[model samples]
Every structure is written in structure tokens, then in C-alpha cells.
Target: MKKLTTLFLGTLLFMNNLFAQDQGKRFYKLPIYGKYFETSQQFHRVDTLKYNTMPASVKKLYTNSAGLFVTFKSNSSELYAKWCVTDKKVGLNLTAIANKGLDVYIKNRAGRWQYAGSKGTVKTCEDGLILEHLDSTEKEFLVYLPLYDETTSLEIGVEEGASFVELPNPFKRNIVVYGSSIVHGASASRPGMAYPALLSRRTGFNFLNFGVSGNARMEKEVVHMLGDINPDVFILDCVPNSSPEQVSERTVYLVSYLREKHPNTPIIMIPSVIRELSYFHQNWNNRNHLQNANWKTEYNKLIAKGGKALYYLDTSSLLGEDHEATTDGTHPSDLGFMRMVEQIEPFVLDVMKKHNIH
Candidate 1:
């Protein structure tokens, strides 16, 4: 009787294995977008060789793949993702999906990018279904990486014999945004919810994110690196991470260095978004007022000194009046990020037009 039972269990296990193997899929590497250096294959925003020179905090956050995505065209009836993330931890205020997950977007027939599906298990590596049971029509797909984790490896899986093609970047030029944690995609539910990513989809521009969390203080080394990129447009939103004194001292130097690098590029400065927690905390309130004031003073000085092609972004309505836009009163929730893109997109488009940034 025992031998009969063991033989029956063995046969069942073998059948299950055969069934899983029959569902095998083929994977293809997708081209990454939004990385600062094209030569980097590690999904890092900046060149890894220079990591030792950057601030320790920046060195860590630059690998988070905050604004990176992969694009491809496929006609498979179903889709899956095989990915490995550097971290498998989630923050108290951040979603596990946002930390180490995948979000997929598909371009509809009307030429609009829409969310399709997402997968998040907070594992070091995972192979899971993203979407299935489609009509097998060829379409462009965009998959956003984790918002707060480093993507060491990523590949899209499709049924065997399905047509798949990696797509090239479709944007015109790079619009580099340098800022703090808000730019680093903190508290966003997914990677694509970051304001820079939102701005990219809305305006059809390649907005590269250089959001160095806790280290966008405009230090000499960091500013030098920014100057080296010489993007078509530069947006500085680092006031939230810098003290009033630092702003007063660093603003001029940072802008001046970049101006000297790319004399014709448009340089815009934005003050920090209003933190809702500041309403009741006197210290927080005072800090906001001072930093913004210092920023305005620096902008005036730059303009007075014949800083042409310089612009200022009005951030009064960046978070709206409801005071419910933030997850922790510091970083924006997805709602807040959407509100910011709505306000910022038009102003940025107008600025680019004036500067002939096509």
C-alpha cells in the first residue's frame, strides 16, 4: 500500500512540472530611457565610475532608477516580467510596488499612454505575469522600473514565436531636472507617477531626472557634473534640500556655472512645494518662508546681472490648497504629482517655445 501511494504522488508531481514547462516564455532585453549616461547598462541615472566622487547620499540614490523606463513593441497574447532589484525593502510611507516593482503602460490607438498593469512582491528577483489574454495585436509598451530601488536586471517575457521589437527613444531633447527627494520619487505609488515622468508623457519631451535625495544642495562637484551634461534645458528645484544660508551662497554659483557651460540653454529655478505640515509647525513654516525668500532674492540678483534665458517657476499652487497632497508632508502623493504636472507642463512648453527648444 505504501509503495502504491508513493508511486501515485511521484506521477502527480511529474505532471505538474510538465504543465509548467509547457507554458515557457521567451524574454528580450528592453532599451532603457531616462538614464543620464547612455553607456551605463546598470540602470543608473549617472555614470557609475564617478560614484566615488559624488556625495554618499547621491551615490546611493542615483542607482534607484527613479525615472527610468523600457519601451518595446510586442504582439503577444500575454506578457510577463523577469526582473531583479537591488533592494527588497519597503518604506513605512512608501508602497512595496513603488520600492521594488514594475508598472506597465501601453499606447492606445489614439496615441495616448495608459496604464495597463503592475506587479510588486518586494522580492530580490521575480518572474510574474503582468497582463494576459490580449487580442495579440502589435502595440507599443512602456514598462516603468521601481521608484525607490535599483534595477539590476530586467527583461520582458512573451509567448514563444510572438513578434517583439525594442523601440528607440521618441523624445526630442533632454530637459534635465535637478532637485531633492521630491524629484527622487519618494512616496509616489509607482515609478511613472514622478512629476518629471508625468511631464515627459504630457509634453513629449525627454526629461532626465537628476533628483539626488538629501544631496541636491548644489555642491561644487555636483554642479560641475550638471554642467558637463549641458542639456537643452535645466530646472533647479533643490531649495527644499538646502538651508537658507546654503541657498544664498550656492544659488549664484550653481546657476553661473551652468550658464557658462551652455550659454544658450534655458535655466529655470523653482522653489520648494508647500509642505502641508508646515501649517501647524512653526519651525517648518519659518523654514519654508526663508528658503523661498532667499531663492527669490537670488533669482533677482541673477536677472539683474544680465542672466538672459532664465525663468522662474511659480510654485504657489504646486500642491494645491487642500493640504492633502502629500504622503508625509514632504514628498508628494500621486495626486500631488499629477497636480504639479498639470500646472508645470504648460509653463514649460511656453518656455521651450520661447527658447526654440524643438
Candidate 2:
């Protein structure tokens, strides 16, 4: 009994020491994304919201740190981040699922992006955070920003005596995507697992995710702002937010606006993913079909109008007929997200190949 008690005390002390070490070590930190963070960090967002004298509405949307990446080379064995989110309350996804989370990816010697580790906070990043700890060898790393939540403050921290420098943007062309909540990362397990994030990784290309939850209606304000982008391919996946009437009304204008602005840029249109409610409820089927029909009509019209760089993707098989791809019947689960990438990446790569944007 005495020996056991001693051993217990020793184990407890060791555990405490580990926590103390984690708490005591200070990190050499860097902020590497966002417009507000540009002078201090490498900024990735230049959407419609960045212009001078921009409207208050646009400012509210562009303020978040979504779709930003922190590129760096570090030799630290420990990785940490200090972040405070604007929204701490958990929504459809859990707090850890949506808000206080960080994912770290490292490039292997074979030039493949591999998942190194992930961190979750029960509290908020206002209290700071400690993410993955790696070997003390120098390596290239990219940290993806949170998808659903807005960040107020962010800093990447590494161990002392580690060599660190900002990584230059590697790709020449941008993978521009626009859509609704799913594009904004509804139920993704982490910020890094969002469909756009996955697509960027698989292709090793740059991307800008313009998915705003419930607000990506085919508004002229949004589309007109989008016209300024000169992307390799502009992906449209916002039909789920629009009604059939809106689809018929706005689809032509949206395509024409983009085509007028980027005459040679390939535009890819993605209709709504298959909904589980359609298989169970007739109303859902009718509503979804109507919207798709309207969108199809507009796409065909654009083709007839001599859309030289247009590409329309029929996503009927995106989530598959089995209908097990979503967290609810609406948003996709991680499994569904993987399935989505597998299907979508091939088509995107094909478009990229055709345009020589690879």
C-alpha cells in the first residue's frame, strides 16, 4: 500500500510538471493572414469588401478571418496559437467543431501535404492556445483559418530558438469559389476540412472561399463585387439559397456579369447537392427540381450566347443516392465532404488542365 501510494504521488507530480511546461513556455509568434493583418501578416483576402468607401454591409461580411492561411517555415518542436473569436457560442456545429479549433498541416519530403495534428479549446482563444508539437527540425507548414467563426485576434507561436520566416505564396492562379453555408463550412469537423479547403490541398492551388451562411443569395451587390476577380475558375454553388424564381431571375445576370468581367476565365456552375428530404418528401423534390431547372435554363442560354469558357457540372451524384453523406439531410458530414472532394476535384483539375492553370 505504501509503495502504491508513492507511485501514485510520483505519477501525479509528473503529470503536473507536463501541464506546467505547457503553460510556462512562451512562443515566438506571428500573424500571417487577413487584410487588417497585412503589414504584420501575409493577407489572402481581396474580395469586394476591401475597396475604399465600401458599404457598411460589405464591411460586416469581409471582416472575418475566414479562408486565410498562415504559411511559415519553422524548426520548433512545439506549435501554439493565440486567438480570440468573435463568436464563442456553439451553433449547428459544436464549439470545438466550429469555433475554437486549429489544424496544422506539414509538407512531407515527398511533397505531399500531410496532416500533422489538430487542437481544440474548450474555452476561447482569448485565453491563447497550444496546438501540435513537432520535431525540432525545420519544415514548411500551412495553417488554415476557421471556416464558420470570425476571428478577432490570431497569432502563431513556435518554440524558442526556432528559425521562422513567412512563406511566400506558391501558386500563380487562384481557385475562387462562391456559395452558401456549405461553402461557409456548415458541419465540417474542422476549419480545414471545408470543401474549398480540401480542394485547395488536393490541387496545391490558392483559393478564396466566398461562402457566407444564408446570405449568398444571387444579389447584384455580391455578384458585381465578384466581377473584379480574375480567377482561373470561378465556382458557383449558391443555388441552395435561392428559390426557383430567384434562380430563373438571377442566373443569367450572374453569368453575364462574370463573363463580361473575365471573358476568358473558366466559370464552373454547381447546382445544389442532392437533399435527403427529396427522397422522403415530394415537396422537397419539386422545389429542388424547379430551382435546378431554372439554373439549367440559364446555363443553356449562356452556352447559346457563346460562352467560350463556361463549364456546367451536374452534381446529381455528388453525395450519391445512398444519401448518407450529410450530418443532417442538408449539410455534409466529414465522410460526405471527402466524397464531395473526390468527385469535385477531378472535374476542377480537368478544367484547370484545359486552361493550363495547373
Who wins the TM-score comparison?
1
lDDT of 2 at 337: 77
**Sequence-dependent TM-score of model 1:** 0.92
Cα RMSDs, all models:
3.9, 7.6
**Local error of candidate 1 at 113, Å?**
0.9
Model 1 alpha-carbon miss at residue 285, Å: 0.5
Q: What is the lDDT of residue 351 in candidate 2?
A: 88
Deviating ranges (above 4 Å) for candidate 2: 1-61, 126-133
lDDT of 2 by residue, 61-106 (tens): 5554556667788887777776666544666544474445677788
Taking all chains together, each candidate's TM-score versus the true structure is 0.92, 0.84
TM-score of 2: 0.84
Q: Candidate 1 residues 76-119, lDDT tens each?
A: 98999888987546887788787888888889988978888888
Total clashes in model 1, counting residue pairs 3 or more apart in sequence or in different chains? 0
